[model samples]
Target: MAMAFNSDSELFPMVNVNNAKLSIEEERRENVDEENRRKDLPINECMGEKDANLDAIIARYAETINKYNLRNLGYPTNQDFNYDKLAPLFHFHLNNAGDPFVGSSFSLNSSPFEVSVLDWFANLWNIDNSEYWGYVTTGGSEGNLHGILVGREQFPDGILYTSQESHYSIFKIARMYRMHCVKVGSLFSGEIDCVQLEASLLSHKDKPAIINLNIGTTMKGGIDDLDLVIQTLKKCGFTRDRFYIHCDGALFGIMLPFIKQALKVSFKKPIGSVTISGHKFLGCPSPCGVVITRLKYMSAISRDVGIIASRDATITGSRCGHAPIFLWYALKKRGLIGLENEVHECIMKAHYLLNLLRDAGIGAMLNEFSNIVVFERPLDDDFNRSWNLACSGNIAHVVVLQHVSVEMLDTFVHEFIEKRSIWSKDEQFKPLCIANDVGSKNCACLMHTTYHITFSFLSTFVTYPTTHSCSPPPAATSITVLRRLQPQILPPPPSSPSKDSDLTTVVLMPTLRSTTVVATVAVVAAILTLSLLGIYYLCLTLL
Candidate 1:
């Protein structure tokens, strides 16, 4: 059955239960044995040229990365790119010191290419060449740093507000600047909770607000509503002068413009700056990014620094000039139509992967405008390592990049099904119920399916008032008492649906560590204590 999703971005992924503890132990042993097959050479040790140790090491390293690349499905990096044509430029020392547009006395810089690349992005982001001032950054993090820094420079006492699901770089940038940072609640889809954002804005009305909105989140691929965010600011009484909005569209920035009628990122909007990575969807061979802000804001960062004989505006004095060339090449080669085709192809592949998982009796979810197919985490450690999957506690996702084709997806699905079947032994495996995380309707687990499916993330109240006798420990509250001892006792499938309907409540303990549990409970108030930090940041979902 298909895992249907609501507009709110709820995802209840189904996972197979652990049948044998011994099987896991055996797999761990095998994994340890396999680790010995690939020995790491000590870098500090001297290599004799006569033995060809250097050549052997390079060959082994190349082979390993190639194999890993074949199975790579976790990260957002688009691996379908060729830079062989630009490899000739690697011989020279091409460094864009100081500002990209500003000509340096050092003539070895490739600032012309850098400027051209910046112009390309500026045009894509709806910023005119004459009206915008920006340079090719090291990557998305640098772009974020520069964008947010400009906001801080403009409004020195501004409070940085970002969704909790934002890239770690946002918070890191906040810390680096030593500015007051406010972590806002987000929807399960990873988009910013504008309701919560407005409340946060209202609370911090005394200070200037600097909002960091995601073009697309790192984990769940959620796109924060720019229009709604702007509306939220206005409702909270922050005008154009008092607030600065910096959009971090690291992955989605380039993709969004190509997407027809997508949330338009225009200079016409009341946005301070926009940033995106060249490596992510654009497929730059090296890490590179672009940040385009109004020409007016350039004065805050740019000034004559005598040593470099140019404006010292960027985060780093010397930038990787080659990165710009690579980005330029990618933009020139793909053009607008080529990129649009790749974007459509990726979204299609993501939908196909979702179907493959669902048809195999696994619950999965794909957001309406995302290429990230989120599913239940594989219980086996070796299986995760083999695919190089990126997994959180209960969920694992496959980012369907341009290189991830139907054949590769087919092989992955087939292998996953085969391994799961062998592990389960004639359909003995019970599935984990994630009704609390995703809504009940989407949860394909035996218990969740049997129960009422009307409950939502914030409203789904599961009370453990029953002191019903079980082989368990004393009670903290009804919910935490018996479940804490062996929380994840997933029930086996009943012969009939009516067989288990007599039971009032079946506790589906979440797969969260004590630390993650603290964060999780704080997010969605399942219990009575919803008000933490004077903010009712509701639970579950991906946001």
Candidate 2:
């Protein structure tokens, strides 16, 4: 005879307990042993002659890199590109020595290609071709260096101001130039705190302001409000001439133009310069970027170079001519429509990852119009290293670039969930509190969980039944339920909690009783029915 269940709870249980424990420490040890296998490989000692051994070493390195690329998820680098056709150009050393606009005596330069790439960006950024002057940089850091240099040249005594969340390169540049830098605070969403910025500006009213705005922050993918920032500057009594805003777009510089309703990084606004990384979103074979500033700004720093037969306006003397071609090819091949589709796809994948994490009861957050999904940092170092997860403080982020696919994300989430189970098996091992990092609403810490439940219960005023109570379970039980949800891993406890645990004791324990519980169930059922009817009627009226 088949088993028959009268209730849904009997048919489909909420938690299927798993008592087995996985040996993750052994697995971590195995990984360390494997990593040490190549420790005794060839060093920087010069080889006497070209031999088969050298070729073998190169081949082995390539194979290793190919394997590693599969798990390269931490950084915001797009690995989905094929530049095989451009490989033939590597035969000659190509260098753009000086200003691309001015004719260089060195006929080997790819200045035409570089100019075409700059013109495309200028148009995209709403700057007239004649009004803008820029060059292909080695990377985003070089771009920032050049953009900030332009601002510094304009205002020699100007104080540099950037949010604390801005790229580390910004502060480094300030140090290199020996400029006074004011690091403003950022909001919970990782965006620049305008209030703090306003205060900083007011305090430094004596000195002219040279602001470095992040189009997309490194860790959080937070877009500092350009309009609001500009408004703040004006409100602080800074005139257009008194301030110079340099936008370090980097990963999002090439992407933002393609996104509709996104704040435009344009010269039409009061921005002095804009820089974007070619390798980040475009997936160039090598690290490269573009920096565009007003043509008038060039006059302050540029000098005629007779050796190169061109003006010396750029940061570096010998620029990679091939970088421009790689950038140009990417832009032309994708066009606007292809790039736009890719941006949307990346954002969608980010949302997919966020939903998957939240559904698994992991604390996660995704900022609006961003492809970076922030979540609680994994406790296992081996797990973090295996997936190449970028972590800061209590939070970790996965930058969903064009190369990241849904299948890859699914695998990543699966592994993360599995590893998390192992990390939380001990009754004492509690999930880290990421409330300060991602805000309480998104955080799944015990303290925040209580707040969330209380808010929800208050919103619908219908009391929960003793049997079917809505209160959060005990720490051990909640961990068990989560493990049941992801049954593939029956793992062990983590090392230790990084911070203090806020594991609260549960109050409303479930009861298998009848008297008052039955009456409470009836009221709760009626309330849910009425709430559904109200939503149905609201939808009908809107239609």
State the RMSD for candidate 2.
19.7
Model 1 lDDT tens row, 48-74: 545556766677767777887898898
TM-score of predicted model 2? 0.78
Q: Native-vs-model 2 lDDT?
A: 0.83
- CA displacement after TM-score superposition, residue 517 of candidate 2 (Å): 20
Tell me the lDDT of candidate 1: 0.77
Error of 1 at 155 (Å): 1.3
Q: Over the stretch 22-114, how does candidate 2's per-residue lDDT look in tens digits?
A: 245545555565664643335233247554477667776778777668887889889999999899999989999999999699999899999
For each candidate, the alpha-carbon lDDT, in order, equals 0.77, 0.83
Worst 10 residues of 1 by lDDT: 533-542
